[model samples]
Target: MNGDIKEDIRSLSLTDLEKFFADQNEKTFRANQVYEWFWKKSCRSINDMTNLSKPVRKILEDHFSFPVLHIEKEYISRDRTVKSTFRLHDRLMIEGVLIPDGNRTTACISSQVGCQLGCTFCATGLFGFKRNLAFTEIFDQVVELTNQSLHHFNVPLSNIVLMGMGEPLLNYEEVKRAILMITSEDGLGMSPQRITLSTVGIPNMIRKLADDHLRIHLAISLHTADNVKRSIIVPLNKKYPLEELRDALKYYHEKTGKRFTLEYLMFANMNDSLSDAHNLAEFCKSFPVKINLIGYNQVPDLDFKRPESGKIIAFKEFLEKKNMIVNIRKSRGEDIEAACGQLALKDRNQREG
Candidate 1:
């Protein structure tokens, strides 16, 4: 943070705000009012706190800044999926998506500017790591997408998936804080159950998330069950292999007593074979889990192709035959590059220019 840059007011806790008001010889309740405007009301500017006196607003304006992530550009797919390029205060860019299904809409938000986990199938990995988004930045994505949902689909955002750019567990602290704010009564008031954090199975961090017991859904991006194949695609697998990941997931289940989701992005002729399906089934035996067989969105220069429709059905049937809960998740927003593994910042040079 530069000295010239005023601190983000949302970074202060309720207690910190209350203390600040008391120090200014103001009523402590003013902090509660400001806090409500910050989170519950989603106020973008201090002047939007209409309930506050002008003098109080002046005090806030003088001390702290209310910077917001503004949309630089947005694209709508044929299926009504909206992909937005959000410009951060520092001029860094990130992406978010709003997918409308019937009456329900899901907002997929990014946790980091770019991903360090170099998954070969994901475009975000190609851009390389930049920085973790502040908790406020993460929360702002949801607010903006919620507005988009109402504007486009005439429905409120029903769910949130941290399945956008970077791995959530890699940026644990800020991600956790953002989740807390999103689910808290003082904030958006969305249910914890409505949120899902997708990650590439960081072993120790998985254990940490399990112990913390955040109560949100966990979805692992386990494209393949075979370690050698997994390592080739998801380079992080070479460091924390499938065995360790399995143990960590087992611990998560034992600790939380929750069934997590395994997201399998089916690649044609690679991990879509019957043997690979058998390996995936065997891997699921240790813990209670549901499987989401996702259709891979074709990224430019990425050789990984979507499996044939028949192969995808066969894979889903194989799991169903073994009494597993399975769903073939339809890839949305491929045209706008908002589907899974496709959220690399395409407007970087444009924003920089």
Candidate 2:
């Protein structure tokens, strides 16, 4: 790369692209057309912009680079979930999962190369923080996964979840931009209601998201309601405790009038007691929230074990008795390491080691 080379054209917004085209003495409408190709069509090369003149395409190729993620490895589970390990331009790896359930398919995409929040129960945390993915990188996961869903299941992706690899709120700006591109009429034209952003409960950032007034759903990874127990598992909870998170969720619910989901992973002999269920039930009373009881997916080197069926049933019954909405989210693709909390690039980690 040369100092004189232009930046990634995909990084430019429509307004920036318009200015660039204007400076090039080209019609401003060309910018909109090119922007459509970059985002809407997810074109990987300047040559893919067939609507543009050869001279214009040549100019783009000479000035800008379209560094797209290449699928280095793909694993499919018996349950038909697909986990893909993508190699970025610098060869850093990130993972994304395509989860299928009947007619609906969900794309679980990553926002960063690795995770900054070191939740003890998570595999991504084992890698430490690598880098925040570019907005293009985030959007590319959705595009690629959507294609996979259509190809494998003969159905388009019905939902998108920012629940893979990294804490989405940490890469707020890029995630925000990616969401805008994803839901824009000229881009994917997907409904924001179909997207969910999951976080390990970053309080101030959660409040900020409320202020932004986005229509997407939010899911808080609140494995335990007790602050002491929570902090031991999700280390970020020490910074943003349950009280702060409660206030943030209150604000978010009041502002958007949208019900959010609280994700609780049931671990055997760990936060699966009757008292723990009571604490979680009380926590949900603060805001309009649905409880998603998820079974722990075994990760290498982690001592946490999935709770028995009887314990999960007892916990769900307890929440239901409290007049709270609860759904048990079945773990998908665990055999292929594509289940909930299992999106870490384990093969890459082994290779790096």
Candidate 3:
């Protein structure tokens, strides 16, 4: 550890905080109060903990540091979807979006500064990999977006989607820690059922999540059922493959007894045919799952286009006929580049340049 760098208080667990307080000759209860300030109040600085005595506050200020995100840019779509670009302490940028549909407001947040898995159609992959976000950084995105939903729509956030930029399972440990903080009574206190984690089907990680028995919803990005076609779009599939992914999902279902979700992006003339639908339906038969058929969101320099309405309808009808639950989720915030697979760090780079 660098001698000049103070410890980040947010990184310490409650027990660790208590130990530090004990060493300082302060009561252990002070740890609980500080934890509440760090998590419940989302305080960015020690000065904001006015409830602490001046002497204790001074000591904390000298020994600890809090790193918080600064909102760099915010955009609201005509559909009332809000997207915010946040600048980290190291100046890397990440995005979070608040999407409102009737009574439900979902916060879609990122887990990494940039993405390592170079999915061919994703904008975030264009920037290449930067680093995984700390647990506090992930938790902060939810708190910020929850506040945004309340401020803009006068409604609390009802759902969370780990689908904004990076593959969440790649940052599994920090993401899991952030989820615990979000659902803890001392923190945001949201139910696990309302949270959904979407991944690009990392097989071993999927099995690990099942072994841990986490009840939060899981979504697999399965763009196509054909192994070769899927690998072309999502390169990670080349490593995990379709057979391994299917077995992993089955294991997950058998262990948790929870139905997972399959996210399919329909691209024009690419994977939107009736045959494609039949293949997808057959794949879902391996486990209890629902299909979320998303229309492709155009990214800069990408050749793919959204499937035609007639083609989309035909494909969905085919799946429904096969007794598979299917939903066609419309792309939101397209005008502001806030739709699925559209998140990039270019704005931050341009500003820095």
Candidate 4:
């Protein structure tokens, strides 16, 4: 934290904003002006905020920088999925993706450097736990990625997905703050309906998100239904099993009346069998949810492999026979390693190599 160029202003909330203005011997109106620049305009440098006096800008710049990650490497897929790694002030790096569909562009933002969940099939989890991202850093990702791909992305981030590096719910408060900032009209001007947070079934946070009345969609990473197989792949299943997860989803639907999605990744012989698909359909019968069958993107150095095209077709057909509405998701960035579970390159890793 000491070495990182952490700007003090980045940590200020609504109350802290007033405090900072008072501490700087300025009127409270100054705080609101700065908030407009940061939240509304998404300004990075102090010089960009022209409303503030030159003397005031100088004081703020000397005290705090606009904590944002500079773009390090950008990889564009042939299909137009752009994945970029950003280097933070501390030299720590994170990845953000701009996935362009027919008329919509979704920005997949990361909540942390690495993951603590340790899901066996995921490349991000394989890296192990790193600290959660700060609020400023998290916000910077959305703004920066949007600015980077403005020319191409059909929509200005029609959807905001927390399906990147870390387990978003584990970094609860920061994720909550980031969501609030995204949803606030004064800020990113994003509608909550457009945002979807994908989790490996964090029960408590699921119910908490529902309780808070956030209208965002929930996508649960339910790779398997068998407790034994699920535990082997997703370690968090030991804490919150299928039964508990079912109850939580039930509660969430009851509270929000929103239909959640069950994200099942297809891994060759692992969880792509006909019986496994049947188990998944049976598992979700108790809750109101749709199924999004994601075809895995093979990561280098990972043991898990993507299922065959025939296997994907057979599994989707089997689920459909069970009256389940399932859509087989196309892999977005295979050529550039920017697809589902394939964002592993970082500035530190590059430097070390």
Which predicted model would earn the best lDDT?
1
TM-score rank, highest first? 3, 1, 2, 4
Q: Write the per-residue lDDT of candidate 2 for residues 1-353, one digit (tens) a residue.
A: 35986688798889998988898898999999999998788898899999999999998888788888887888999999999988888778898999999899999999988898889999888878889999999999898898899899999999999999898998999999999999998899999999999998888899899889778999999999999999999988888899999998998988888899999999999999999999998888868789999989999999999999899999999889988999999999999988887777776553252
lDDT of 1 by residue, 1-353 (tens): 35778778989999999999999999999989989998999989999999989999899888888889999899999999999999998888999999999999999999998898889998999988878999999999999999999999999999999999898998999999999999999998999999999999999999999998799999999999999999999999999999999999999999999999999999999999889999999999999999999989999978889988999999899889999999999999999989999998775594352
For every candidate structure, what is the RMSD over all alpha carbons to the true structure, in angstroms?
1.4, 1.5, 1.3, 2.3
- lDDT at residue 72 of model 2 (Cα atoms): 81
Residue 185 in candidate 1, Cα distance off native in Å: 1.0
lDDT of 4 at 51: 88
Extract clashing residue pairs from model 1: none
In order, candidate lDDTs are: 0.92, 0.90, 0.90, 0.84
Separately for all candidates shown, the number of backbone clashes (residues 3 or more apart, or on different chains) is 0, 0, 0, 0
Candidate 3, 114-134: lDDT as tens digits:
799999999988877788999
Q: Whose TM-score is higher: candidate 3's or candidate 4's? A: 3
TM-score of 3: 0.97
Candidate 2, after superposition: displacement of residue 58 in Å? 1.1
